[model samples]
Target: MPSDVRALLARHLPGREARSLVPVGQGLDNVAYEIDGELIVRCAREPDPEATRAEVAVLAAVAPISPLPVPEVVFSDPSAGVIAYRRLPGRPLHRHPVADPRRLAEPLGAFLGALHAVPPASLGELVPLDRYPLADLREEAAQEYEAVAAHVPPEHRRLVEDFLAADPPADPLAESPEEAAAGTAGARLCHNDLGAEHLLADPGTGTLTGVIDWTDAALTDPARDFARLYRDLGPEVYELTLAHYDGRLDDAATGRVRFLARCALVEDLAHGLGPGPRHYADAALAHLVRTFTG
Candidate 1:
């Protein structure tokens, strides 16, 4: 199989041999192999042709514009559900503490700023940004809540719902998930799956080196990016991220960010409650208490 993958790359690359190929990563959506430990070859685990094509198109367009290193689709064959690209440096951010969160925030903010600034029209036939209608998110949140309703402590269930439904708090630190669904922030291209796991980082330097997984990329509320920042690193990092951004997210936009942040916690706690750490649930509980009391 390594020989086959290498042969595939050879065909596309012409002169360069894609060597030392070995399976390196596997997940729900993709199974990846590193070639010479410098390049990555991936195949979609499912049958999603449109997504395969869009990922290639989006990467090709964004790599040149992104402030951080992004994968280049060195070779792609949607018909075979195969793709190859030069791997960027660093391990996944989730694997290490961002040593100096403050310093990393500056570049991360710049990276997202450049990402959002990309012209969506240039994305061509790739999936466009989702509007993520207020109604849809509300329904999704309700569904996620229902998924875990049985496990929530009886006393905390109602409070959970309120947090999901309330408007942004008058205070920036306090707010509801609903307000996050509705905010004044202008929409732009977003990495719909910009999670901590997707952020690649240099542990030695405490700096992010790359952003990955654009299969779900689209133009959506900028808050989606902000929300992930809030969830993965907490509000302090989120604030630093925003402070470094070239764009401005007004007060209403902040309401949305806070709400979405809370929603992220609830969605996880409510629907995925067994056999894993409760860190997210704990965070959600703390925010819920702060929201209800303040």
Candidate 2:
């Protein structure tokens, strides 16, 4: 552990006995430490106190109403961009193979249903509107595909090219004059980064355990989350997940989900080939074949 981290723990947790303290994850924005396998302490990589504060508040707001367990803030020092919470159970779904993947569908659906039901206005101050337009996603995916296409297998190249040539789905939030006028009228509270790396499950039974990493929570189209589910887990689980979801699932939403899933897949593949960790690239390659072929 770094000297600064040790000092932070010494100052805040004066008498608590910790058998072990070790770094667990180092992402672009934060460094996380596991304390005795029970607590998670995360410190922001940048000095963004406001963002850290928002994450703390969002976790508090989400914990009570979430269908699955979410991290609960136990200690915080927003000025330092540090917070600790009791570690929720289960490993990230991407890292652990579940005995029966189908079993996770219902709970995953219910979890998303609960999140989408929360009025965006309720968490108006803490979460910002996810302003990333679908056009931007398409543009980025195209750029990424250009860089990584040579590495992709010949069999999958045509599928990828076809996706790139296709027109994007209509934006459900901006479809109608009334919805456009209302500004985020069709939007909902969303776990805007609901990828497999953030989803947790029981390795033995495939039970949904918890969701983590709320830094990307936002007021956005619900289809984005659905897209992530489809990209990471595949169609069968995605369809079953939707079966349990109680929110909007019309043709427009389905179109957005499909389009967004493809965009995300391309982005992940590119990242995996670049500065991202080997696991990211490995997972993306596996999903790419599964996503395009299946």
Candidate 3:
């Protein structure tokens, strides 16, 4: 696949030969490579030419409008489900912890504001609508917790259990509890999988260089993206982010953010103890302590 990818780059972007092709990351849906440290090449695990084409279009539309750096596609081969983008600078926030996470507040806030401001109707057809059911999220979290419970710290077990037993907050945009539970009120185009690993930053300056991996980008609950910050960075950063955001999310939406954050934390914790990178588990464990104690 690397050889194929190199050939694709050579063909589409002639003269930009890859000197070193290093596997940087792999998720369930895609595998990513860094080409000579200047470019990122991602190939979908499942070949879907149409989806790859749509993603290329989505990146093109978003790059101009986003306040922070987003992927700039240099080469794309929809037939091979491969896309190459100019590499954005900075290390991921998870692996490279900043001295002050609060530094992320303003830029991240402004970035998300710009993203959510894009008219959902503009990319409505290209991106899928993700109404991740609240019931399903909770049930999945519960199951994940059970699978990794023995690895969880004794001090945090009670809090984890309590969160699992509690009901999720009602969807602010939904008309009724039933509608909320069914997740019928997703209202904005969101980076549905925003998390520390995908957030790149300059470790020294605490400047967010980019938000990567838009594979899960969708029209979903606005709070969903915010929840990642809350879960990974804590409340102060979350609240500061809200301050800079041009859009208003009322108290109910804020509640939903907290609810989703806790749910996501469980999944992170499980991932940490599972097959994911060591930093994932480390970050999750630290977040767990910071969340309840700080």
Candidate 4:
């Protein structure tokens, strides 16, 4: 543990000694550490501290209303850019291989639906939608695709460009104006990155025990949350999960799902081709093409 980390922890959790600081896992923008016994500390790597503060605030606000258990922010010091939370019980859903995806689908979908049901008025000021806009995502994809096009095969490059060129769907599933609004009224407190890794589940029951990682939490389109399920789990599981949520394969929802799936694929591709690219990019791209075209 860094000396700075010890000092930071000492400031918030006074008296108690921070026994062992072990690296927990890699986060998109923050480094996570499992503090002594039950506490988890997240520190910002970049200069920006707002993200940490926002996460703390959002978690605090949503803890009472959220259907599934959320980590409680026990200690937070935005200046030090470190936030501490009481670690919940159970392991992330991804930790144990899910033998039957259907069994887990209902609980996951219902949990998400309940989360979306939280009135937007309840959540205070959240990050703007423009920050996570589909247009911005598309632009980023185009830029990243151009930069890495040379390394990609000619055939793959053409296909990616063509996919990028296709316009995104306008109709969204959450029809209520409140549901449509990104940050203000329509936006529910959303766990923007709801992957298996973020979900804690009981191995025996296959039920979601807790939802972790609030760094990307925002008040945005509920469909974005559903899109996450589609991308992380395959189509069959995705369909099952949506069905569990009473989500129909309507044209509007389907179109939006297709668009978001493509966007997520592009996002994954951009990150995958970064310094030490991961192999999952190929799978994401393949899935994107199949879903969009089919």
Deviation of model 4 at 108, angstroms? 1.6
Candidate 3: residue pairs that collide: none
Q: How many backbone clashes does every candidate have?
A: 3, 0, 0, 1
Instruction: Residues 34-115, candidate 4: write the lDDT tens digits.
Output: 8776888877767357777777877877777667899888888787677778878777654564667667777777777777
Stretches of candidate 4 off by over 4 Å are 47-49, 93-96, 130-133, 148-162, 171-186, 202-205, 246-251, 275-294
On a 0 to 1 TM-score scale, where does candidate 2 land against the true structure? 0.94
| Residue 246 lDDT in candidate 4 | 44
Task: Pick the TM-score winner.
Answer: 2
- Model 2, runs deviating above 4 Å: 174-179
Runs with alpha carbons beyond 4 Å of true place in candidate 1? 1-23, 121-124, 149-159, 165-185, 267-294
Note the Cα lDDT for every prediction shown: 0.70, 0.82, 0.82, 0.68
- What are the per-residue Cα lDDT tens digits for candidate 3 across 170-265? 655764575467554646778888898889999988888998888778878889999999988898999899999997565688777877887888
Candidate 1's residue-wise lDDT over 1-294, tens digit each? 567676777777888875477886655567789988888888777747777888888887788888898887778878757778889888876556667767778888998889877755465556564666654565677788887777677887787677667654332221345435543135567887776767888888887888887877876777778887776666777888888899645567766776676666666565336434454455455455443322
Clashing pairs in 1: 129-219, 169-175, 180-256
